[model samples]
Target: MSHHMTKNHPDSPNGQDDISKNDSGNPTIHEIIDIRLSRRGLLKGGAGMVAGGFMSMGLSACVSDSSKTATTAKGFSLGFTAVAKSLNDVLSVPTGYTASILYRTGDPINGATPAYVNDGTDTAASFDFRAGDHHDGMAYFGMASGGSGMDLNNSSRGIVCMNHENINQQFLHTAAEAGVGFSTAARVAAQIDKEVNAHGVSVIEISKAGGTFSVNTASTYNRRLTAASDMDIYGPARGDTLMVTSYSNAGQKTRGTLNNCAMGITPWGTYLTCEENWAGYFKRPASGGLSAKMATAQNRYIGSSSSNGSYGWANPTGGDTSGTGLYDRWNINLTGADATADYRYAANTFGWVVEIDPFAPASIPRKRTALGRFGHEGAMPAPAVAGKPVVFYMGDDSRGEYIYKYVSTANWSSADVGGGLAAGNKYLDDGKFYVAKFNSDGSGSWVELNIANPTISGYATYAFANQADVLINCRLAADAVGATPMDRPEWTGVNPSTGDIYITLTNNSDRGKTGTTTGGKSRGLDAANPRYYSDLKGAATQTGNVNGHIIRIRESAKDHSATTFQWDIYLFGAEAGADATNINVSSLTADNDFSSPDGLWFSRAVPGLMWLQTDDGAYTDVTNCMMLAALPGTMGDGAATTITNTAVPANGNANQTVATIAGKKATTDTLRRFLVGPKGCEITGITETPDGQTIFVNIQHPGENTALADVASNTTASFESHWPDGGNARPRSATVVITKNGGGLIGS
Candidate 1:
């Protein structure tokens, strides 16, 4: 899995647009104010760690230090740091370990299919059933042998379920080389198919022996779920008129899932993959032809044509007139006889948490509508409690969106163990979705999204049509209920040991801006999102809640279904040299400083060991994206401290902090940088064996350097990153597994 192999086109200064030219100038006054108030309250009020609370909890495993020393205790050794220059570079680990590519873009998983050519020309038919690209969040589920959940010690064969976030056009096609100029309708179709194939999850069986792991290519469990695969629609929105189509007369089923990002596995053995950035994959007709209501919906969801035509799928066939059915699907226009006859079905299909059974190859993944959808990042289930309902936490990954929780209607029972579709029918098909609203007094309420609730039914803000509309347009529903908007809520990870939920609020730049505010939208900061500062180095260009922060919520009764909870900020992202007065919240220093925290996962085997990975561009000038492992204490670490940003006068509270292990300075040792990635590579999608002996991580989009010509030889060398290539070579986005040579637990 070399980064070079992932490049479909040579590096060039005039590369495909990266910053999403879709920017409609600055956000509208309403959008700006909505984001401003949400961020202000989140950071300033609700997110502070209580200083002295966790001390008596017996979690004092370490103290701060000034030197870089590998503190080893209880047989666990702090692993060596691996350096990667970019997304294309190969992984570098400690001397005793080795790495391999278990899977990559276009890898066939059905059977005797040819290996991926590592070029951009793979056939679309083949990709219709193959693994997707930009692998993100993933989980490793040990297979059950002769019934009961596989014995933790005897489990040698397991299913590796990984999410294919999005596609990289430069690495997937050769538009420039094919003499087929990029952006044409035909060119866009090819790119669309390639991306559509690469957007779901790949479930492959993997085996480990002699301290090394490899894909069991011939295993029956190996499966690839592409965007074309038919999936069942479940929950309140299922079978609704909004989802009906000629393709699905029942209206309870959809064609496929797209933009599948981070994922989670339920205790019952089902995989939950989320859809993020799904809005960018659709294309609405130009403004003049659309109704005002329809136009507003289209613009609100996807954007205008200036947004690049939703991957160009509508181009080749006829630019919405392409008679070819394949090309016509991407054209989200209303020209057909009716909504069912046109691509309106496209909008109805995406944006839900899809459930897949890795063991059932013939099974169609189900889009669980019960979990209200809107840029779903990941779904983490709380440890199952006997007789109680299953609680799953999720985040809507967008600036000024809300966090959500789904409580299954069915109670937990041992009979549901390994129950497959039946279990999903019993639990996932019906559930209550709730949104978080952190109060100023430190307590929070999970407002139920039920149509029967007065807050929802009697609300005068946004119309509460029905449960279907609520789930389909969850952001609006959350806004109506006054759910606290967050700074790009990305991933949510539940501590297996404690039911505490950790959410990554990847930076939001719209906060603090003032303008004509819309109904139900506030204009200042509050408790949940409370920081506003300009990066010192690029102050002129950057503003708002730039660095971002991690928020942790503790349920009052340790019950996932509990509506009330306490909240705090685990850590505030900033540069090492940030001014203590404004920037430093947890009092962080050089050894561990980060920004735009994205991918987050908590090890089931290692209770206190939480892993944090970053996908960032704002702080790239100082350091590349990274992954850190933390031995975090439970909630209540810092006292409430207000954060005041002159630009946006918001009130923010500080979270609890302890001495850093790297330096005796008072900070949050509960979070620390475990690994740093190569240049331009986002360190994400991590999984480890149940024993914690083997770990697998994805290094995505490595050599994204901005300059390089079409020359095959020269363009490859221009990018400074060559990851997974131990000897200064081209980088490739691939998965690498790190295990101890002596066959011991990782990070131990």
Candidate 2:
């Protein structure tokens, strides 16, 4: 999500309110990058150094070490002409590719449901059978040709599980509905019902015929799990007191999952839908006599104690006629006497990685607490090796947060293929969680985040009563263990060809800012987060790492369980014409430059191919968000270098320096723009078929910038974008299928 979209509402779901309180005094990534660059004598030069200095070094192009330099993947080169940047109200793909709308917001997933009316007159109950809004982070599970079960090799038929992260309130309702307290505490019950049912995840069947994919409206597997759905709590914190709520006295169950972002797939054929920015959905006022323990946890995990909650999900009056506390559950204030009396602990039930069995629609989703609670962007599992433990890499999607990995106690086995939730119970219930600690030598270590660690149990900031407490408050433990604070860690993915893990450190506004800690914690540039400058977006001047960067780590000796790993900056997001000395460190050209890298996934069928998506605001003035294809070489492919950052006028107009290990600058042969999304929309959530011939990409929140006043006034000409179904229709978030013109491999 883009911060610029909600600048007026700081408490909005994707806003920067849920920042890190990592005052651990541990060295940040910027400091490590500075140490390494200085040790290699890379920062000795002045600020006038040219970007070509890195290209002249001629680094290795292989994705692995020197021993595997000659074994490049079969399709290592980008084959299509790069799409030019566009501000059009429609998706733009490469010249040889065709993109067709596959699914959209409010589209019916079942044959019995009525077609979407686009005028917002559809019944609130009908959205339960329709596709949710803001399509994001999807995966394809191949279906057997004979309509039996899953078949990994099948490409023509499959089920798509996608996250409907949020809704566009203005567009989803009519003018009269908005005037009836949609944005206030007295929100209309019918409007709130529609909004609540429009969130969470959606699973629909789709098939390919004549090179086009369409939703299978009559498939028995089609279903939508919304914010009001019932789910089971699993793992260490299942019966813990912290999870207790009015709905679940045993704390073993909860209603609904919110803010579902990126997703992952388990070897047992289950979907891992992560919950990001979920804290914003709760209201926790300071007037409630909040205990010190509760306040500490709330201020650290959620932001400010005076929050009114995003969208006022807790405000519908006298609405729970069924005694289910449907609307009251969103209020986390300690109004009642105990945890069982009110929903004070309801927020804790959220923010965990939820596992859903798409194949079995009746199965209940489970919240995997073993993965540690935070604003999880995605949980990317490392390739499951027989007899080895199942491993997953995760990122906390907030500024100055940490990257974490989970190693299940149970080893992987092929026999668990169809085990579903039972397999999830076996492999996801007991796991050793660790957070990354990057060192100045370019090597990193995974620090254990368990209460058993002396640093965690003996901490003075917050008391850990048990393992459940530690898992529930793992961010505090990470701070206690001195984990490295990253630059707004987002989607994480593991390279299929090399077993390397990559995490997108989406831009941080607080980086390199001079002053006492503000907007999370402030610090100067470092090796892993080396770039810091000012960006002019429209009339507003944005500072810090205006254009984010991606960092990758390779486990020692190719072992997923290794505590040590080596890391490097894979690519820096910058405009093609930015200053080459400091900002455009990646040496990107017009054909491949990007900003605020968000969604990332390495192709399972295309060997070393990787897809990079953007959720940008700084660069939106020039172009809409986009997706790019890359044959990214592995870690250590480039040398250490120095970046001399020049502060904007707002930051004192002084120059500062930092050292970083830069990857080999991307070229036209290795990276190119594949698609650009519609105006005011973000290009994210991508997956392809087994044959790599068809790819599904999600366009989130199209026309998101449209003002509520404009929608209320019916000012059609003032709309930012009307995409997918264009002629005067309201813009909608949709999933589109992209394929090569004649059904050859996509991006080839």
Candidate 3:
């Protein structure tokens, strides 16, 4: 049975001292979007079913008193509603705060001639060095004064590194509008170049003066590492025959990072950007056909034959068979005389963490092969402990995937702080990667993936040739090691003050209720993935952890190197009212209700301050996705609460409870929803000023619901969310800064 609830647990100060407090003594402000009696609460109070699966809880309240109690007790007072909206428009913040478009899709880099026009149609050559689309994970690293590491605390100027996740094909094509001409090779090449430029991270120097920040566009540090950029593969996996290609004489280094998602920064001052959902970029020839082994591998990476090629790179005229090497490289189907003749390693190059030095413009980004490749969501480093090995946590984003950690071979040292890439070479180039196996009895282990210790070679389940092979095909190795499967792990954040790690398991529709026979691959409700419920929008309906959960993992020794950890469900996500037995894992009230927890972060300024962002399809009926802030108690603060699976009746009652919070119900005293977004937008990626006075947050993909044809007009207004515009206007994902009128630490 799952350890659903904790019973009278002790409150140990494991990672507590690490939590930051607001030094400026300013009160925080909170605004509640909706308040009502929940349908589940009504059902438990004796209500019957209603039509459309939305059991209405009478509008009897407005924000829970529990939320106010939690906030006041912590000395924080929520602030004004700076950018409320119904129509799709860019978000804006309160006065004294300002925001500018630092970079956007098709923004030119590399000192190119005829700068980007901001239109969709940019040439391939111009795009080879331009900014990519869909900015996701990012980091800000302060540069040392005099170009040396001695002035580490100085923040005069810093490198701003941001990830370009993916492209919007519907927005990219002019022909799709005319519906006459087809996408050609040149068009595909241009798209590929733009996408490549966008995939990896862009490092640009940003400086602040007079309370405003601007990018030093011409700074020598400005560089875009894209899909076509040359990147060296390091670690035991480097130079493996599987990584060989006609382009690489050494059979190791390869081109580009793709689908770069969330990121991590090392203690040594290097950036770690991860690749996710990279499998759809290529196509295999149908007639020639891939060999059995090759097909299996290809299918494992990408999907089945029915999956359409992204960017139309497969069509001959679209560049799949052009005389230029560009078009030919996308064909992963066995085409040439041998592996060396074609780009068999094309898929192999992506899905690994690419490390770059923000200070070194001339240095090439290295794809660290030691961190076993998968659908890498993000890599988060534990606080550097002196004389101890540095630990990095990661998650595979696919459903039923695994959580992973990599421990550096060398121990931490104060000297490594400013070492940059050289420090990465020492710590990250070689390391031990382990996968987590969470037990139901409130304990977990980090199963090592070392080939020697794992005896992977002798394992009968799957064949492993060497360490390189093990790292290259990490999922198989993880399965062999019996790693616990998770529910679509996404971004991860660590409480800088407390060592607790927070992971977002976005959502899994195919879980629990779906009777797919893929045993270990298809999962049901367990302690870790307790919720199993469905939600409704206007017409769309979704189920199975429809709302997600935030899981906090605490190392047993209060150190990241420890093999054992204690974990607890920090929050359960749902609408104001839903099935209490399934959706309300932590007994959350209306003030803190949410769904599909995605972008999660803890404040660098305030140790206990946690920000939760939602990327949801389940609760669109009430509002769009949103962001919430919480002052969470540590892992051992609450008693374990039992969670029952109402949707999947036969799952047989898995138990879960708040282990440490004695005499406390899952109420607003613990969590509160802070901000909600406009229609069809995911509120994500938040940062604060060094003094904690100013806050910067991103509102991504506004007007995402507007059709391609409706691009000419302000379609977002019809949907009732003209956010930054406040009226009928187009919506663009933009960052906004928030600062108190009195200029003090935020959320104090």
* Candidate 1 worst ten-residue window by lDDT: 1-10
Between candidates 1 and 2, which one is better according to lDDT? 2
- For candidate 3, give the lDDT: 0.61
Candidate with the greatest TM-score versus the true structure: 2
Report the candidate with higher lDDT, 2 versus 3. Answer: 2
Q: Which window of 10 residues has the lowest lDDT sum in candidate 2?
A: 58-67
lDDT of 2 at 549: 93
- Candidate 2 TM-score over all chains jointly: 0.92
Give lDDT tens digits, candidate 1, residues 1-748. Answer: 0000011111111211111111112222223233222232000112232233222111111112322334423233344332222221223333344345566566677667776665556776677556677777888888765553433344466888888776655556653532443553455555666666766778888777765577877777777787767888887888887777656666877666777777877767788988877666555666557766455445445544433354665666445343435566656777578866867766767888898987787899988888876778888888888899988888876666678999998889867778876798788878788989876556789998878877666655445668887787666567566677677787888877667889988776655455313322343455667665655433434666677788888998888899899888877777766767456766766556777778888877677577888877766666667776665556776666655564423323222111111111233333455555656777788988888877888877666552334323335556465454433333456676766546776654
- Model 3: per-residue lDDT, tens digit, 181-217? 3243334455555445555667767667776566666
- Which has the greatest lDDT? 2
- Ranking of all candidate structures by their lDDT, best first: 2, 1, 3
Give the TM-score (vs. native) of candidate 1. 0.83
Clashing pairs in 2: 30-526, 33-527
Better of 2 and 3 by TM-score: 2
Would you list the C-alpha lDDT of every candidate in the order shown? Answer: 0.64, 0.81, 0.61
Q: How high is the lDDT of residue 494 in model 3?
A: 80
Model 1 CA lDDT for position 597:
78
Q: Which is the winner by TM-score between candidate 1 and candidate 3?
A: 1
